[model samples]
Target: MGKSRVHWLRFLRLTSSFRRCPLSKRSLIIASVCVFHLLLVVSHFGYSQHQLERGIDEDKYRNARGFYNLDISDALSDSDLQTGASFVVPTRSNVVYITLKSKRLKPAHIRGTIRPKLRRKVRRKETNSAFTQYKLVTLERDAGQNKRNFASKTSLGETRDVYYKSLDITYISPTDTRIDSHISSIRIYSQRAPPWLSPKDVEVMRFLADANVLRIKEVSHGDSPTLLVFEGKTSVPKKNRKHTVCGGQCGVINIPVDTSEVFAFHLDRVLGLNRTLPAVSRKFSFLHDGQPCPVVSWDASLYPEGLAAGLSTVRLTWGEYQNSLKQRCWHKNISPKPDSGCFTVHHYEWSKLALFDFLLQIHNRLDHSCCGFRPRQEDVCVELGHHAQCGDPNHIQLTNIIHRDHNPRHLVFTNNKGFFDRNEDNLDFRLLEGIKELPEQAVSVLKSKRLREKLLQSLFLDQTYWESQGGRQGIDKLIDVIERRAMVLLTYINAHGIKVITMHV
Candidate 1:
């Protein structure tokens, strides 16, 4: 009471002073300004103290409010995996198809589907409207196997088929507008890959193709034999979700079933060379307009050639093509050093490529008429260029180097359609002889009897994919020839003695 009296006395004295001085316009204005400033200062202090006591950070409050307002339901609609959870009538459907996705939050009512007789307590508050406000009560399970059929983060990492019907969902809560039921949604992280292709390159390609995500930036001018080298980016889905596949620009080669590209990729993986671009077996399905179409696997560009008019495309071999490269030597054109004619360091990679071709009995390495592009040496498209030049494996063009931009000294074997000849004994090592160097691992793998056995077993496991494509006989022959070639390679390496060179240049 004494403090209040003192404050009142001070306020009266200030008012009396203002009254005495502020009769004039300038004095009245000065007094008003002083009072306004004092009020602002007092208001700011009160606001700060209130905020501190309440633990209310303005920035954090705004951020949290915005987060709660985010509509996850709309995102689920745009995703590849469909949403299954929803509010329905008491008598819902018996079977519900749910996508096996990751870290899905399901409602407790879902449990009632399995155990209909069980009752659980639900705290509900009545609102002014028909709806009821309720909080979510959840029992989380570990990531591994559980009897509850609930999966936690990282527990259900793999894709599995879940079978349930609509009737399986029990109504744990009474149907009332007041009751705020939990909204459950599934988010599929990784999906099952195709059985026929490798996991990375081919699997992503297939996904892009199926999702209509591929946009062909250009159909290269040098592409041949109906093979289209697609330079495109994987379109981001409208769902705003990340994918397990490639999203940025990458190269994809479309080739026929008879081509050795797929086999070469498989062999590359088996040998651990990883020098080849990954390949997946894809049949023609869509048109340029992204419409469904049934068509043969052949390059549309070949229709302009005179030879294509009468030739049976299936019978056309890479060995049959002859071009200007045959008349001249590429060594004179693409010498690595300033003026040396000896094999360049790239010859070491050529040696590996040569041995790979020899193992498959492929001789199109130097044949332009084969399924290779004869681009003007300057206008070569890396993605669409020829795999082999037309002169000698020892004299290779710089552009023919695969992954040239990334690894200049290394070779990338592509367009491998002309392989697996009937003659298993005719193994050519001309290219391998140029470098006179072989990967020690390649030599060891070739020499290991146990490795050969494992390779045969793996090949047999992959036979299913080939057999589905009606290439069982070809796969069997390929396996047998590979075994024979391994023996031949072992003998050749042993007789000549391989030298391993480890120079970057």
Candidate 2:
């Protein structure tokens, strides 16, 4: 008690004196302590003045888009954050009322009704009927608060409501045809926005969903029809116009499909079967750490017709691949050839030759429209001039797709090596768009080729196309788009500790 109590008393006195010190010295001591504490805090929590930002971090995950990334990078897009967006539910009395900015629509009024406005713009030439409701939306920040990230790409947070309903609209139409005549079919899709969502976010998404509504109905016709899909009033392009391209409504709607059901829906079922090619490689094997191979059998590159529908040319690249033909674990089951060019590398799985071929088929759809009688070959003829190419025992290897309607969803060869090849060729192959990996169940669902073949015959040959022995150039294109996106997504998945492969096309 003597020594311990004396020390304790002294410590307490010192603490009290420090707390009760005079202003100037106390302030300096306190500031010094704060600076040390602040430095520690800064090291722990404030490494980046900006990295902590939720929406703006560049090192975040972003979707892999096939086209030029007109959308935001590695951040939740405007499409992802839907607030105050309006939708109509067909109800017994009236469509379910989605009160977005109810103060403006006024639910209190007895006769109050909200209808989907044809907010997307149509082209209008002077004295032309195509131009209707055309205008530009400039998302300028209010005075003083203007900054680069704020002005250049409207921050998703600041996007309170869509400029669509609020902005002044100018009507335009094409020269010859009347607006009423040109509008063949208008499809409007409405969904109740999640209640917790911000009104502005909802407005942006509702506009996008509604905008894609028209596209979901368009048939994969020629360039003119595809152009019509874009140029039409309901088209997102027409809506986006001089304003940011695919901006307001678009940056948000890329819903990530679940991995289980990669080939979940039929074309008609999804995009309601109407929306075309959703958003739309290669290998090296047969070597022992720069070793050799026994034989080599490779195919030429494949392509797609998945662009905006007009005849746009597409090219694919596999970069550098192996040249070694020295085969170690060559599968004799594939062919009579002893050293079947396919080799099993630990990571690079397929031999360079096999990878090239794998990537090529994955790149093309409508069945590698080289010279074959595979499922989608006929579609190639329709879209990209006739190229009667067939998957061969020696050359073109047939792939099994999940749609099974006409084409098999499975690859021509499935190795434990873990290679995946998906694409956007025709109706069947088109469904695989934007998906990073084949649904875990696609393999199981595709067990019976009978159902798939029947579906294919009906959807592709009978329901969609028949009598004309032709396929669209779309098959190869479909394969290419899917392969590219899958690579990007797989890259992200790998980073997150999810197992995946580079996967051949």
Runs of candidate 1 with Cα error greater than 4 angstroms are: 1-218, 222-257, 286-338, 341-347, 366-399, 450-465, 468-474, 500-505
Candidate-wise lDDT, in order: 0.39, 0.27
Best by lDDT: 1
Instruction: Tell me the TM-score of model 1.
Output: 0.40
| Stretches of candidate 2 exceeding 4 Å from the true structure | 1-126, 130-244, 250-366, 370-439, 443-505
Local accuracy of candidate 2 as per-residue lDDT tens digits, 454-498: 223222311112111122232223333434543443344456453
Task: Compute each candidate's TM-score over C-alphas.
Answer: 0.40, 0.23
* Total clashing pairs in model 2: 91
Displacement of residue 180 (Cα, Å) in model 1 is: 32
